[model samples]
Target: MTALGTYVKVWLALIALTGLTVTAAGLHLGSLSVLAAILIASVKSSLVLSFFMNLRSEERVFKVMLGVAMATMAVIMLLTFVDVWYR
Candidate 1:
């Protein structure tokens, strides 16, 4: 298959995953619903990043950049959570 064909497939799958996330929000799952949503979103994001962004075959530098970016965001999230934790 062509690159475009793979892209279309991934895009359609992402759409379905999005619908699932929205559907999940409507259902009651006690305290685990939010966690489930985050997990699915992460998976969907990975699919886009790997296929749409073409990161799966990229060079090591690109992977390093992604790691750095993700780490920075994680640090910021942790800092934010610190305040929430204290509250």
Candidate 2:
């Protein structure tokens, strides 16, 4: 697909994800609601990183770095959750 076509598709996906995020917020799922929102936000961020940021064409090192960063953030989030749960 052309650049414009790809961008349009990503834009549409972002819009749909945004709507889903809003809908998820309205529901009373307690702890699951936070997880759902985080998962949806992660998907949206991944789409933006892969498409809008043109990360697909980036070098392997950059991709690896991004992965490490994401992993680190995940670990931190998990720690926070554990701490909160124990308290």
* Model number with the top lDDT: 2
Model 2 agreement with the true structure over 8-80: per-residue lDDT tens digits:
9999999999999899999988899999999999899999998998898888998999989989999999999
Tens-digit lDDT string for candidate 1 (29-82): 868899989999999999988888889898999999999999999999999999
Error of 1 at 17 (Å): 0.3
lDDT of 1 at 69: 97
Candidate 2 segments whose C-alpha is farther than 4 A from its true place: 75-87
Give each model's whole-structure lDDT: 0.92, 0.92
User: Which residue pairs clash within candidate 2?
Assistant: none
**What's the lDDT for residue 41 in model 1?**
95
Model 2: residue 10 alpha-carbon error in angstroms: 0.5
Q: How accurate locally is residue 55 in candidate 1, as Cα lDDT from 0 to 100?
A: 91
TM-score of each: 0.84, 0.78
